[model samples]
Target: MAILSSNYSLESTYSLESTYSLDSIGLHTGLIKCPNCGQFHSNAMAPHGHAVWADMPKDTVDLTQDLIKMGVYSSEVVDLAKTLTENQLKVSLSQFFRDSLFERSASRNRLILEQPDLEQPDYELNSSNLVDRLCLEVVQEAGGIQAAFAAAFGDRQGELFENTIKTGKFNRRQFLARVLTVAALIMLTNCQKDNTADLTSDSPNDLAQKLEKNQLKIGFMPVTCATPIIMSQPLGFYEKYGLKVELVKMQNWAQVRDAAIAGELDAYHMIAAMPLAISLGLGSARFPIKLASIENINGNAMTAAIKHKNKVKSAANLKGFTIAIPFIYSMNNLLLRYYLAAGGVNPDRDVKLVVLTPADMVIKLANGEIDAMMCPGPFNQTAVAEKLGFIHILSSEIWPGHPCCCLATGQPWIEENPTTFRALNKAIIDGCNYASQSQHRPEIARAIAAPEYLNQPESLVKAVLTGSFEDGLGNTHNVRDRIDFDPYPWKSFSYWITTQFQRWNLMPSNVDHEAIADEVFLTGLARHLAKKLGQTPPTVILRKEQLKYDQFDPTDPESYLQGQIKKHGF
Candidate 1:
């Protein structure tokens, strides 16, 4: 007597790839049988050219109307209607409406009283099989037999249920039965819930399964350098592709680089210079480190306090001033040294180099403790906003376009969990794309402002999200344009690192930099994404190819100067 239906059409060709079909007799019109399941039911399989109760697409609404007439709240009925299918709608509607009929009432009552005899325990059920059990429970609770039959087989409940009963396993009857049972429980409970459960599921195992089993702990030095990776986590890109990312913040690049080399950290928002230093054992560690994904390039700026603004314009103006940088071998040092030398001033003699952390650089500049320092993003924005100082030269202004920050994971982590690496890489790429677009700026800004990381005001967040860089020079520019977001050019950067290693005596003169870069970043999961997405991937720099050291090595002290000359016909 339970009405079931479908949206299938008799005239339409069925996509029988996974079709389920059933047959049943109608309770009301006395039709012995009908094609109620699959294509036939959804396609208007009704008698006398009139549609069966559940044969129509909008049958659920009609059923809700019947429940409303029976004094159910319109809202509550509508809520319940969400669980009801077209056939279930029609069958449930017909049953309740015809409950007033004496003959049908007895039949409905008898059907309920004569519950089917128990069968042999051929099927086993457990927590692992909860979905199947829950499904049946749902069907039974959904108005019991009628609801179950109507929801699954539509008007063909007799045939569908009979077949399923014979099979004694998963079939339309079992699936519908379980679905209705759970839905009915939910409806009767009328449970009020909140986002805590809805937004994030209680299944930690399931959530964890959504990410890679292995871990990659990348470090960041409070500077805005780690923006890409941080942006990826909140964007759900990391989890979508299965990556367990541990973002650790370090106090300085020294710690960041040290942790990376010691394997205490898998990666960090690394300086192009640091990778070179690590690959060659330059400043501290002698271990060769690798670069997987370049996070950003050329947003860094060399800034000075407002009081020293008049004392310096370019490196030439700093003839005798004490200039502060984050560290001795820091990118700030290399860039300033290279730039001052390019401008014809000896970095070792013309300027007294003072070393400090990025945070200290800001404080010192504010307190007039340091003359100028190289800083990035919000810090620079903060300093400039407070009238702290003007930027004598930004990396993007001096170097124009070059790689700056990178997602430098340890070589060992990259070897395992290749899938996870690809996922993380894809997420980082997606996050960068999201961050770059103006329309997505607000979304990215809101995400950064949230508590997970980089908690800042909306305006400040957007300033960085939009890639704006202002060095207090009264000249603000979009820094993203000067950034090579995908700077995986293995040879370009690897050779540069190798040369720095040799220059700083960190690596042997003949150590294969290109081979090391390839082993770390160029191979593995990232390649799959590049192929799948049709992206021109980051090039794997290798030692086999001749190094392009003259083009990028800061140790040459005149590369940028030569670059400026080459571009301007100097």
Candidate 2:
């Protein structure tokens, strides 16, 4: 049995007819299943009583205890994101700042896992069929409640809605209801009129036509996961492709996201989850985002401060510890929780996670402010360089070839500037190919180690790039793929991410995960660039084998989420 569990309760109820304004945050209403009755309920169910969530109102969602525990290290950046999300501020504010804040606060009391919580709810539901129907009806119905009802059930809204008897799909149906209610409460949060002006593109015969915008601005953080993007600027890959690129090194993930959202950046290095979060309107709904290509694979590790090397040998010692991850909705959090759950440690009950940017992770670890951190790049290597931390496990050992970073851009930018997009993709593709070669890694290291780039010791940067580095236990290891660059955006990777969001309740409800993955992940761009570069792309796009978890099957996600999650699954 897993150590962590949730004392399951139902969701909060807000009046559907609440005074409407054009701008509102997400609707507070949601639905949960009754463990005893085996039926769905919209209000707080019995057995789990009403309680304050993270000291916030019950209407706001509550995170798992594992996330709550990490609240001790929460930063002000989170408040800014919430403010930006709940209400409009600057047009690009949400995308420009560092995402170092936890959306949740921690309870002062000891976290006890209860018998029931949010995990698998019998079966998966197709949200698109529902939301699309609702979104369309709302558009066609002319106005008011009739539009919402037509959108919800199309024809069966009042028939099934007013009845007391509930079916198995009732929980799924109710979620759409909440979405509709929220949609009604808030008329799209976008205050700015979208700019869809089309830019010039290539003539089929002249596929290599001049770009619409050649001067490109990109954003990055000083982490190892972004080696290709960072190295591209100095290695002349961008120049080789006839593009002048300026890499804006940002302080944190929030800033990276905000800048991208605000159009301050043409493209950026981002966590695999960040793009997904933005597309779902988790952080900001203003801009539709698209991922150009995956930037890295297996380029991270769980590093603990050197002082705790002896005291903290395994997951058991991590209880009551404050650990840090680069941001919310990231692979680091997924990997850490998997490790904890597999080791019989309840992440929510035993420890907490706080959001810290990759660079700050080294400083905080050294100061003993954070016991450990799962972060990307040179920061993990920097920790060993400074003798501040030791590597407990290379993230690859947990999930090999697991994606880390991506080359992502706002969707508006992609549509308006297709020619520029291809040029940028070609440059990025060329850089990825160059970085993949082991022989050139040392030179690549020297290029990115400039004061303007990573600004780290060349040797430290070289070690990670060349797959040879100190493991922080005094022994040197040559770890190939320690930090690698790959541009393929496998559907499996996207599907896998969707499962995690559902497992943790980061998403409102089940949507067409594969469809969304295909829409946002520009696999077509990778293929086009690969052909242009005379490189053969992978014949198979979906990953054939699972890495760390024997249970994770993207096709059958609930089997893993419900059966594998120690406390919440049951």
Candidate 3:
């Protein structure tokens, strides 16, 4: 019986004429050639009709013969043949006919066993067994045939295959390259699923034993600036690593540094430039320091109150106006100057910068106490929502990319308790990871802006979490980049700060930028924690580069002063 149906496409691989043709071999009996498949088939049916074929057991040949007699075939072999005939049988022939006589014969064919190439002394006694071993290994390595084909053959395999068939040996360079590529790909595939990093050698309690108890008081600002430290302490991560952590809420960065300089606070979150500035005695606290790790990155906003809205339209409009900032040496000051200069204004001469806490700045800005405030998160969001200020500058856009916060301790404290630093670093790293995850961000945001912290509206809290804040110029940024906490703390960021200090004459140019940056910080501690946690600790980390202001020569007083006056609306 020859089957013909319209459901099957004529584009099938088997010749259509053969599909309409009749009896030849045991399996081809009575079937006709299909336009796609030049083979005989049993019964033709519509797409939904399955009357000609019925499922049958693999070992029952009588069932198959009986079905053939009845013009209905359904044994495993006949069903498979019918399936292949009805649809495009796209498969490796070896896999398709695994139970067939041809497959059994091919498996039995062994040139090595028959020819005894094993007589070669160089070949091992098990060399004849290697084919099966190699096939298994290939299956494991390739994951499947498609991967094997893609790796063994180039992406454009048709062309390469033609060339290889023409030549005796396949292109060695291409083959070797593909092999190496496959090997690397397999390694990467295995690495991504690895849970080794998740399993720490020491328990949190054991890790904590490495540190001293209750002695380390860390001063952190109340804003989202100190979030990692806050999250770390409350989450019991600090305790897990043997830290008796007292999270001191400082009013501002200046006070935090003052506490650090005076040996009251062991550590604090600081602008990347703070250590260099402190080492040079540029600020209120002139203490030598050792940075532990990066704390956070890119979350500062400069804003102007509506009361001063008419007074400062752009960076150029703030030439003579007094602006509130946390510290003169902080990124707030540097970034403000950077933006003003970009707008053709010199911050040094044109603007009267008033130092104030971020909270106080918002209050002052709301009441028209200050023209503008360069403040960090949560508060920045509050200020904007309260219409206390329009965004004047966003640090992320100005610098494009850079770590914003560095966890630094007084040099004296680090020297006294090395293990404590390491333990704390691990906890902080854990906290950073926790805070960056999408699932944890909402809770982190709410926790940071809780009643005890900023005590702001939940919406404002969510805004900070989403990194949705306005630049004074009506630009908005949604910051989702993770906070990198476990990296070489003293690297290019310190050098950049040093260079800026020199460029703006914030510090003497001759000072060794490298020495200050390369100072042995607690990066070893961070690495130990990372190794324990199975993460690759950062060897070198540069804070996001500082934004470039409009190119202005600071040396010439005339150019500097005039640039400030004209650009910043002095």
Q: For residues 1-570, what per-residue lDDT tens digits would candidate 1 score against the true structure?
A: 122223222111111100111112222342222111101112111245455444433433233234334443333323322223223333333433334334443433211111111110101110122223323433544446456546554566444434433343333333333233222222222121111121133243454453335356767765555667776667765655445677776777778877887788655677766665676566775665655566765667777778876667566777776677776555566666657655666766777788777667778888876677766655666677789987666666655555567766665554444334445666666565555556776686677566556655667656665666565767876755433345343344454544444443445556554445443343323333443445554322221222112344322223433464454332
| Per-residue lDDT value at 444 in model 2 | 86
RMSD of each: 25.5, 19.5, 26.2
The residue-by-residue lDDT of candidate 3 on 373-437, one tens digit each, is 87777777777776666776566666655557777877667546555655666667778766666
Pairwise lDDT winner, candidates 1 and 2: 2
Model 1 superposed RMSD (Cα): 25.5
Best by lDDT: 2
- TM-scores of the models, in the given order? 0.54, 0.63, 0.57
Whole-model lDDT, model 3: 0.53
Ranking by TM-score: 2, 3, 1
Best-first order by lDDT: 2, 3, 1
Q: Give Cα distance to truth, residue 91, candidate 3, Å.
A: 49
